[model samples]
Target: MGIFRFSDMPLKKKITLIAVVSSSVSLLMACLVFILSESLTFPRVMRQNLSNLAQIIGDNSTAALSFNDSRTAQGLLDTLKANPHILSACLYDLKGQVFARYARPDAPQYWPAVVWEEKSEFSGGSVRIFQPVLSGGDRVGTLYLESDTREMQLRMMDYTLVTVVVGVLAFLISLLVASRLQQRVTGPLQQVVDRMKDIAKGEGDLTKRLEVTGKDEIGEVAEAFNTFVGKLQGVEDMKLDLISVVSHQLKTPVAEINGFIENMMMGLTGELNPKQKTYLDEMRAIGRENYRLITDLLSASKIDRGVVTVDLKPVSTKEVVGLAIRDYEVPLARKGLSLELEGVWEGGMLYADRDKLVEALRNLINNAIKCTDKGSITVRALTEGDMGVIEVADTGIGMDAETMGRLFTKNRVLGKEAHRSGAGLGLYITKNFMKQQNGDITVTSEKGRGTCFKLAVPRFKPGEGGRL
Candidate 1:
């Protein structure tokens, strides 16, 4: 048999078990104390009472015994008839003859024969008390008292039974009360645990507060949790405010700069020398990257606000690919990398937000331009079952496993150039756009070999322009 471990049980069982065990132990202690006291004191009390009874009988029977009056001596010994514990009584003359005697009607069946002795003994649940009768300091006769102790033993057994019954009752009552009170402690803690789970699972609504019931440890825990949530809410609000201001304010000047550069490059301002135009070309590229960063931040803010809207329409696959290629033509040319298009589905179409698809392709093209050093960047498109797959492969310093794992997360810009110029939010925003259009993006890369990005889009069906 194995002993049960208390800690493995639930809290409610622990409380109830503790209460029952404690009450039983306390009751058992009380019962043991009562038994011990009774055992030690009861025998002495019974012996003293027997001794006093013998003395009184001897004192009264002195005259009857000295004169040898059998009737008076019998009457004197008969006084013990009222006490049920006194089984038998005898008055003996100095010659050791039992001159007179009195025996209880309910006395033991076998009694010791009256021996001629001045000594008493205890045997067979009774005590034999032998006391000498004296008259004027002279021994006259002896009084013998035999007391039955069975009644006292039965009384102690009854007391023990009552003690056991009371102990059981106390244990039950204590268990019930402790179980009810234990809920007061575990109930609030359970509520707190539930609320924390809700916050963790759903949209983190830090504004939710707990009900403070009383000034106890549970209340203190609730107060502390509420305080922690308030602090987190403050931090989230501050982060959003800062991002909003920077996204809106910083984009204006950078857009203006791009606008002026375009005007100058198109000969709207003035003609430029080769060196001046080259420097202006570099500046234009930097400005364009900066503008793209700001736009990514603004898009992230919109996503956080749950305002992602996609205006879907039927678009030619060639048109989408053409726009992305033309948008990144300068970066590809600057890096001396050729663009190759393979398996372009000519007649196939897509039902998606045209701008989102083109923008996502543009980010992929820019990423390809950043990583490739030698081989051509290949663009492939084909209809595969119900979806259209657009793949962009780059022969560049590809990403390792760790970089690929966090590639689509915010603030995870990989390359040195990307870290300096990019806000690390492009792929994050692009991923969301793909998801919003019911499409997906995946990547396959190796550290030193190459990398490829695949964008899957829902193919356009008949009578499905924006909704299907």
Candidate 2:
């Protein structure tokens, strides 16, 4: 889990982390190899040097040992004092008796009682070497030399100190280099992310393209993204064309038909029987619903095409709400639902577009009436913080969490039953209209309880020119 999370880290951080870890591991391995090589090589070199010195001494003392002269042999042994690590030296005759010996002033005279064959052994921080004495290809005596191992210990100490210093410097250099170089890779990635965010926020500038620096992977990605956005722009153009046809070719005819139906119901045409009246009534109702759908689709398309403009000014919340509620009075009365106006007088002027505010409120009220079977609808308005708030609450069949999650999305149906009715653009349009006017809408609902939709707009300040 930890590895996966680290792998998911931002590209810049991941690059730096990889550089630092790789440098550190490489440095560690190199240091280990250096120490191991020095350890093995140092002992062999020390043993060879000691053996050469012993061979020279044995050759110099061959005549002295053959004539049994201790002074000459002792003089030859005294040369060992020149090397500080050589603590002591001894010569043993063929009879295994000590013939002549030399010891450093501070070191003890330590030797075996009998001389053995030519060999070397290291023990207790010292090395002892027994080299054979030869004359005319015959073994004469054994020269034993004991030396302290402090030189190898000091050499190792120096190597360790140098390794630590080099490791620290290397690590710092690697970190600095990695940090500087990682920007080449991460900078382009960050640009792509920022551009994607702008597009997602509905800036809708699909003409924007990423600059490609080279024929690298990042460059490839930028090119691919540009291609994708271009295709999307083409699709959006087609959608706008379709909306244009619907506006010019469809809406006018539908409105004329609805008007004719209304005229017939009002007796502008010939009178009708009971069955005919009922049929005409149902047709009018269906015609009204179809007209609403056409208008909603047009509004949604305008919002998407970024052509919807707001004439921002100071608007009276009470007046707007009254005007919007006037259209829904008959629906409320038909449903036998009560209406309550609370805090309406206290609703301060807001910086908004009057028409947009009315449209948003009407949509919310219409939804409330459709969802509600009994109880009442309440419209409230007041000031909160720097914004004026208007709330439309209804005793309706409220939504669950899952339904509310996608409620304001375009063409998202409200419930299983809603799939048979509505283009699902009501809340989506209302929300977008509020946003264009620098206002916002939110809702709160509980299943089987009720729902409340809140519209917030900037409070009107006289000197601010009604700008949000």
* TM-score, per-candidate, Cα-based: 0.63, 0.71
Clashes of each: 0, 0
Using lDDT as the measure, which candidate wins? 2
Candidate 2 clashing pairs? none
Q: Worst 10-residue stretch by lDDT in candidate 1?
A: 108-117
RMSD of each: 7.9, 5.9
Each prediction's whole-model lDDT (CA): 0.82, 0.87
Off by over 4 Å in 2: 1-44, 51-69, 75-99, 102-215, 313-319, 342-351, 381-389, 417-420, 458-468
Native-to-model Cα distance after best TM-score fit, residue 398 in candidate 1, in Å: 3.9
* Model 2 poorest ten-residue lDDT run: 413-422
